[model samples]
Target: MTHIVLVIDDDEERARTAAEQVTDLDWDTDALDVTVLHVFTDNVEGATISQFGPAREARDVLEAAGVDVTLAETSGDPADKIVTYAADEDADVICLSGRKRSPAGKAVFGSVSQSVMLNSDRPVLFCPPE
Candidate 1:
């Protein structure tokens, strides 16, 4: 059976990290289908997800691992959209790059990964950015 993985990140480094985590999964690479999702909260520039460097880079890494990859985009709140997409895609797992932020930093800045982890029902694989 095919395994669906959703990778959501805006930056190239974080996206690459998430892709690496997906490649490390126990599932067979041949059976893994990955969707790289970029949530644009405010896209005044009118950019496409395929044009995003991070999504493309993530695709390269996953493809190198022999996993099928697709680039996707959505506009809205990151946490909300991410959770919606995960359910919409019926993703077996959601991959997110977690930044090491202090509780105070998170309280002030708000963590997307944290919100998604709390709100979504799907399993989440958090790749810490070290």
Candidate 2:
């Protein structure tokens, strides 16, 4: 059976790192399928390939690992879109790079990682930035 892993990130390097970490974990022996999702909340028209550089980098990482990869982009709340995509894809796991933020920071800016972790029914892997 093939397991689908969803990797979400706004930055190219962090997205790549998250996918790499998932590959390193060896969570399952079955074939792995990965989808790197990027959510554009606003200025959707302005979104360019450069904005999704992270998704592309992540695709390379997963592809190099022999995992089938699909990259997707959409416009919506980042956390909501991530959770919805996981459900829509029947993803086995959702992985993302988590930033260490202070309580005030989280309260003020809100944390995408936190929202996804709380909202997702599937297992969420928070890979701290290295």
Candidate 3:
């Protein structure tokens, strides 16, 4: 069976870089099928404009790197959308870029990475932001 890798990220640059890295590794191994899903969440205030740019840029980079990708823009809770997509796609692996949150922030606001990690049945790979 062909394994499908799902990349869930909002930052374009980071997403693209991750996609490229995965693609490079896949090429070397010839073991998996990599598909980048650039999910843009609209629920967060100002996230559309601020986050969309990076997400789009990441898509461009991934395309340039010759990775097969599907771009999706959704307006709702990001974590929910990501989990739903992963389940719907039956993804073998979900890759995401995780942002560090302050102790208080994490305690009070929670993190998307944490949500996905907890909710997803498939394996999740988190890439810390540079």
For model 2, residues 1-130, the per-residue Cα lDDT tens digits are: 4555555656666777788887898655346677777778776468753457787788778778778887777777889888898888888888878777899999999998899989889898889888
The collision pairs in model 3 are 12-54, 12-55, 12-58
Best by lDDT: 1
Candidate 3 residues 14-101, lDDT tens each?
7666665555554523345455554554455645432566556655665666555555555467778878877787787777777778
Give the local distance difference test score of model 1. Answer: 0.82
State in Å the error of residue 130, model 2: 1.3
lDDT of 2 at 53: 75
Better of 1 and 2 by TM-score: 1
In candidate 2, where is summed lDDT lowest over 10 consecutive residues?
Answer: 1-10
TM-score of each candidate structure, all chains considered together: 0.92, 0.86, 0.71
User: Each candidate's lDDT (Cα)?
Assistant: 0.82, 0.76, 0.64
Error of 3 at 13 (Å): 3.9
- Residue pairs of candidate 1 with colliding backbone atoms: none
Off by over 4 Å in 2: 27-30, 44-51
Error of 1 at 71 (Å): 0.7
